[model samples]
Target: DAGITQSPRHKVTETGTPVTLRCHQTENHRYMYWYRQDPGHGLRLIHYSYGVKDTDKGEVSDGYSVSRSKTEDFLLTLESATSSQTSVYFCAIADRGNQPQHFGDGTRLSIL
Candidate 1:
């Protein structure tokens, strides 16, 4: 039970709408990441932040964006979400670069 939480555990929306998922941590870890899990693709990184106001895009960041203004929170936004964006999103945090990451349960989102 490391300090991590994800909001909107379940959601369903239209294909052209916007969606925002949230990740909150209480451990004040310096590394936070957003990833999406698909059936056969495993986990693909969407974005990450190493510190406040310091963020970077990841492999599958085409339609996603993220922000880390405070040490405890990280937000992921899907601009004009599509059916292709329907998947399970997870939030993870690690204390150091090579340490094991702790993950939030997940956010299951679906776009019709």
Candidate 2:
């Protein structure tokens, strides 16, 4: 298994409200990433971290932020929830950049 777990499997909120999703891994992988999956968009990267306190913006970074204060934890936050941002967010872990990644179930977010 991936040894990855995502919190709040499902969530619904009003537009403009802030939302945060958590991803925790027991594998202690060096790379942690956040991505959003939409109907036609597939998976779009939001952010990634290579090590503790080391992070980078991804393909769709606007209105979103991420933090990796520890190797086992990664947090993704939507500063202000919007309808366009409603989607299933997934977290992936990779031991190395070239290695295959493992993914968590996902967090389904809905904005009204």
Candidate 3:
């Protein structure tokens, strides 16, 4: 599990509460990403980081934010949880943008 690890493998939160999910990697990859997987949407990118303090919004960044203060850690934060945001989140890392990414098992989040 040195490649990647996601904390709080599962979580449940009430609507309007703030939730933060962590993704840790030991591979020291250059590209780290946050994605949410849902029934009809498949996998949707939420945010990504190219380097420390460098991040960008993705297709579904509306209700989420990300931070990367180090090479090994990437965090995804749901400012205020909502039922519509309930889904499995996955963290991925790659040496380069074009390289295949390695993904963590996933963090299942449910908001009531």
Candidate 4:
């Protein structure tokens, strides 16, 4: 909580538009991730970066892209907003995959 924060904590946008959410961290952790949480399914990973410029797609990465050019910042961009993309986005960090993750509060996004 204290180590991570997401911008536009709440957002509403029209369908088929582009939206970008910013995730910032103060702990300088090496592993950062973006995940969306929905009703039944638990948090689904969208994308993650192991280090600056080194990233990978995750389970729900279809319309999303990510960039991390610095240790303290990671960005998530939705190429085309869809109603299905409406959900709470969370940013998390871990020293490594084996460690427990620390999460940001969340970003609530809505697509009309």
Candidate 5:
């Protein structure tokens, strides 16, 4: 569990629709991250927040956005979602940069 929870556990959406995933934490950590996993692409970071309102884009962030309003919540949204965005999403929390990150099981999303 790692004190993390991802909403909707599974989702099936159509192409061009909008989708949002929620990640909630009980650890009160300082860093929260959003990532996606695909067959050959592996896991890639989409966005991350170091603290409230302090977020930065990642390599594959062209279609994703994230917001963190507090230490316990991090939200990831895909505006006008596409089939390429169909992947398993993950949320992770880290108490310190040098420490290993703790991750949520993941949210499986499919865009038809």
Candidate 6:
């Protein structure tokens, strides 16, 4: 099945606003992740979910949060957006089947 899919492929917002990015999967893959990409810093994990109603904060999860319900949906939210948060965000998936993680196309967010 297709691993992860994202919505609103592009966005531009002013700082201090709110933004939610959705990640939808074709099947329940046991793991879903949100990451942000910048120039100097490579991909950074923002948050992730292991199962419905089960999630944990990642290394770079200060202003971000995530949730999952059922098997196929994971949501990432930026409660208060900031210019420093302007980045290309990606959603990825993995499972116990030993397959490497796969990612979505990504969302390009520009905070003004």
In model 2, which range of ten residues has the least summed lDDT?
Answer: 95-104
Tens digit per residue, CA lDDT, model 2, 12-79: 99999999999999998999999999998999999999999999999999999999989999999998
lDDT of 2: 0.95
| lDDT (10s digit) by residue, model 3, range 1-112 | 4399998899998999999999999998999999999988889999999999999999999989888989999999989999999999999999999989899999999999
Q: Give the local distance difference test score of model 6.
A: 0.89
For candidate 3, the 10 contiguous residues with the lowest summed lDDT are 1-10
TM-scores for every predicted model = 0.97, 0.98, 0.96, 0.97, 0.96, 0.93
RMSD in angstroms, candidate 3? Answer: 1.0
- Please identify model 5 stretches exceeding 4 Å from their true place: none
Report the error of model 5 at residue 105, Å: 0.7
> When superposed on Cα atoms, how far off is each prediction in RMSD?
0.7, 0.6, 1.0, 0.8, 0.9, 1.6
Relative to the true structure, candidate 1 reaches a TM of 0.97
lDDT of each: 0.94, 0.95, 0.93, 0.94, 0.92, 0.89
Q: Per-residue lDDT tens digits of candidate 1, residues 1-112?
A: 9989999899999988889999999998999999999999999999999999999989999999999989999999988999999999999999986799999999999999
After superposition, the stretches of candidate 3 with alpha carbons farther than 4 Å from their true spots are none
Per-residue C-alpha lDDT of model 4 across residues 13-112, encoded as one tens digit per residue = 9999999999999998899999999999999999999999999999999999999989999999999999999999999999887789999989999999
lDDT of 6 by residue, 28-51 (tens): 689888999999999998888877
- After superposition, which runs of candidate 2 have C-alpha atoms over 4 Å from their true positions? none
Candidate 4, overall lDDT? Answer: 0.94
Per-candidate total of colliding backbone pairs: 0, 0, 0, 0, 0, 0
**Model 6 error, position 100 (Å):** 0.8
